[model samples]
Target: AVTALRLISPSTALRNLGAATGIAGFIVASLILIFYAIVAGWMIAFCLSSVANLLGMSDFAAWLTSFGLWRNILFMLIFITFTIGIISAGVKDGIERWSARLMPALLITLFLLVAYVLTLDGASEGLKVFLLPDFERALSPKLIIAALGAAFFSLSLGVGTMLIYGSYISDDENLPVVGGLVTLVDISIAVLAGFLVLPAMYVALHNGVEIFTPTGALISEDTLIFTVLPELFATMGTAGIVVSFTFFFLMGIAALTSSISMLEVPVAYVIEEHGLKRKTAVSAIGGIIAVASSTILLNFENLFGLVVAFTTRYSQPVLGFMFCIYAGWVWHRDTLLQELRKGNPDVEQGLFWKIWPWYVKLVCPVIILGIFAQSLWG
Candidate 1:
């Protein structure tokens, strides 16, 4: 769908985002990308922690505590360096190859972890909570609103990411089938993550770790991930180190997949617009991101929190609406149909094809606008 954004000026194809909207998208995306490294830095930090545990570093925690800023800088530096290197290697060798191996392995690791957690004493309760949604809470206005925002974020929709990847697809491939497959895999991973993490949460509770704060409210996400989960692993003794290492390593790879895609958007634009080589473009973008990430890392909570709120509360949903509007209204009706019909060039316009034009134009904007208004001002 996003391919259309890059499609109008088709010579560069996957290498370009649209003119005005493209710039707007990049500016909006810049916020999320900067803070996202902090999130990714957490993964790298945990992975390093796991490695230290494996090597029997007695004072690793003390060392990390004393040198927290520098330690984070190192991880963030490594993360940016490796991410830029991978993307600069070009799509087939870099993105696609790593994705082929990492995505499958990510799923397997998640399943195995889920299976292991399910064997714990309190696992069944976790499963019940995950599997059975609380309809009452779900029906609440707040929850419904959150779910709507979540849908956009989880799928990485409304970002030009889809457009970037869409340009990568070969013309002979069936877009609908491919899109559906990608979506299903994404949903599967989310479900599996819940299966894994929720069970671990219950297990943590069974081990007498607090899932909630002393004030009786739920603990913050950062505390749950960095503190509570590690405590859960501590209870398992020696074996937990290996398990924890594996879990964090799995997550690090998962985070890389998303990071690479985010980086590629601006990287592609630079390459096309400036005529720089892939490596040069990647380096330029990497340096920019690294500078931004370093500032956030150094500033810690206040600036980081502001960027997160801006991206989640304002930029992302707005950009998503823009993508929806452009797709539905700006691009010609026949063009979308043609793109959809790439693998099946002669496909007839049934009721679906007939209604879709008007649907995306009329329905999608209204729905997105409603969600955006609700999320921001409602």
Candidate 2:
């Protein structure tokens, strides 16, 4: 974290490492950001569709689809514009403020939805299915590999997010303590969200809304959430209408937060490294993403699948592996020690300082490399 902050100043972190690695990481991160924006556009699109259901617009989706790909392009454009507006405000007034406010509201809204679902007939049954793990599937090589990838993606590990965030954190803050708390809070939210969504899924199932096909395979995951759930909730009249609106609004906010962070990376690089104004940096990058998203929207089938496969299976894991390796091996040991010990003298004398850097050097890189292998071949 400290290294990233120190590096993210006027110099990009990857650039600080070296040009070849820096350019490679930058390309991967940029491509991922582009794909992410388009995927998130679906959330905004669904929010629109969900709201239409609440407002008694029966033919909204069908009618929208009549325009073919142009319909999706419209939502993507709106999503990109909305994200650019938030991120262009820069970090404190924009990203940090929205995160602080919307995260709590999102939690409260989730809990409220969970409470309503609990009142339904099959809520308990849904909870049971979610809580009970299928050990065989869980232990499968494919699932294990996927879970590892998910862990990296969820935490944004090796993604330079921590490095960027490190630059913003105050000197007096206890890094270890704060990092631990964040992990705990993130885990709690994930579990709570599962409790909320799974029970609602069960309730929908009980109401005879189909989530699975006759062959017992899950149906279109997107169809289940964005389309069916809102449609099901809309049946309950006024209170359900409120819930539908809140649910989609909550989803939109979540997508906004993620988009903000992704857009920030390159924007920050341009602003700091090239000495461009923040607004200029944001507008320039936003145009690039908007154009990239439009191209993907036009070729949604082959291009979309190719982007997803390359980023997830190839680029992300490889970058993550390279990051761990660089932090462990390539970066000077004393520099790393200094970064870790900043603002906390005790850290220098502690077991963490004694053990962690070497562990990161020796252990972490190997593990990440193994995971990269698994992601490809396992």
Candidate 3:
């Protein structure tokens, strides 16, 4: 009953709507992992390629980074196996333990990479371009939609991921404070990543790599990791090999951490709803997703972008809107206030306690709907 499907009112209509939303969320999470696993696998492959480069295996390293169905399948399986292995150990031993370790490691590596990237010759230029806002493009509908999608995806909102995680939290914890901390951390890492990537791109250009197309737009925005950064690393000699390995290793950690949560959304549903054991549920669900990843890989030219767009752009926002509606209109305010008062007795006096309920009920849904409508029509 802790699942998103069971989080709403007991009324037949509301319950049915909750079920539909939860199921939609599950599908969205699964679809996201399908392409996500492929990209995560690329991170691992790039890590290994760095190792191969260190060992002077030039041909093998190139093959690792090259596009091939078998390569994608092999690495994707490896990444999924790692995910399944962790999830099989259960939440405390698997998800929590690995996340606690991997996240700190990720931050450390990111800081180090950013520090080194800032020392490069063209980094300041990239920083200028990154920090200075272009007011002309600020109001672009495409930009607004893209930013909305990125924020939703980054926070894992509307997909029941936070809902599932929330089910595991202790009643003694302050939900608002925890949510605030999470938002802050997610934003911080995103900014840090921009620091590393944008500056590093300029550094690549400084090294004579083509970072811009003839029209002045960024070249290979989709493949920037595979092309631009690698070229920048190649110019660094021995240090590049180590930096490359660390960078990709950081990326692999990021992918694995995110994949764990995505897998958990469905795994929790199966174990609680269908009475399957954890290991059995993990293996079954993960295997099915692996098959989906393979299907995407085989039809990479067509399915990859389609799945990404469908899940993140369309499905996620709509599902998110439904969640807002549920939290705002269906759930009784008195019960919500009582729940919030669990950890903080004076929660009613707080700004969040005052604003959140109405905001979530009215403003949040309207904004989500408007943004979604704009995405479709504008």
Candidate 4:
């Protein structure tokens, strides 16, 4: 009874659990943000600059008007449905299990498609554009900032989502190592996506196509893969269908993974606060998102217009600022240190432990606040 009481005490398990939850939430949310932003950004960049020209559109804006918005709305709906369904299945059964299967399939398909694209007439040019970065184009501070934000956001580093997931984890696991591993995986996928799209752009542009804008990447997401890529793939003849399926399938998987994580956040909130059954909460949230997605489909043009209107707006810096505050301010440093050092008795942890108090108390706040200010001003 004494041991149980001690374990369940307000300051021990409950406190640790709360900290862990916050860590998990941060990781998950940031990762989703990072992956989504990178893939979508790369796609936007390519379609706007190169692919549109290949399609022989005299006026890109006119082409966009003809594409309709409902297609995008349908995509958002599918994305939400697939995501919520996975969470509803339970993590072990849904996330890990389904991903284990789908991830392999996605990779295999991507490899096959890449091989085929490599055999195309413009393959050399495609390889050059993607592999050799244009230092001048990529050297901008804005691009660097965007990349960093995309990295942090996609990796789920700063979000409460990671912390929440961490709450469910045992104390013995090393948070830093696990965090690093997830980040690596997230980045690897983003790079792989670049390989996929840049090659396609090279081929499409080889035919005198001018898809992208002069200054930077831009596009209607609805027309992106469906309109743009399809035209490029058509140049591949019968092989295009196979390539198209693989490309869409890969995209679907990425979207699915990110969407599931998003759904998990609200679901976690409901379960922790309302004491509702996890299954019920998942279903309720899923239903709500599904409805929202459907509405988006009903007015696809407005959805696209709105998304584009607010397009360049990035989520990483915003979310990162929130995270720095949560981890550095709302949560106490001593509590965090004790939680961090639970299993590492031999390691010299003084520098980190000692510096963290000030880091969290002063540095993190200043950095995060500065980002917000810069973003507002920039």
Local distance difference test scores for all models: 0.77, 0.72, 0.90, 0.57
Off by over 4 Å in 1: 1-18, 65-67, 214-216, 346-355
* Candidate 2 residue runs with Cα over 4 Å from true position: 1-17, 61-67, 222-224, 227-231, 234-240, 349-351
Better by lDDT, candidate 3 or 2: 3
Ranking by TM-score: 3, 1, 2, 4
Clashes of each: 3, 0, 0, 50
Better of 2 and 4 by TM-score: 2
lDDT of 3 by residue, 163-192 (tens): 889989999999999999999999999999
Each candidate structure's TM-score, on Cα atoms with residue i matched to residue i, is 0.91, 0.86, 0.96, 0.72
Error of 1 at 187 (Å): 0.5
What TM-score does candidate 2 reach?
0.86
Q: Report per-prediction Cα RMSD to one decimal.
A: 3.5, 3.6, 1.5, 7.8
What lDDT is obtained when candidate 3 is compared to the true structure? 0.90
Q: Which ten residues in a row have the lowest lDDT in candidate 1?
A: 9-18
> Model 2, residue 66: displacement in angstroms?
7.3
In candidate 2, the residue pairs with backbone N, CA or C atoms under 3 Å apart (3 or more residues apart, or in different chains) clash, namely none
Q: Write the per-residue lDDT of candidate 1 for residues 117-205, one digit (tens) a residue.
A: 89988989889989998889878876676777877777776667777788888998877668778889888788889988888988988
Query: Which stretches of candidate 4 lie above 4 Å from their native place?
Result: 1-79, 133-137, 157-159, 213-223, 303-316, 346-377
Residue 268, candidate 2: C-alpha displacement in angstroms: 1.2
RMSD of 4: 7.8
Question: Once all C-alphas are superposed, what RMSD does model 3 give against the true structure?
Answer: 1.5
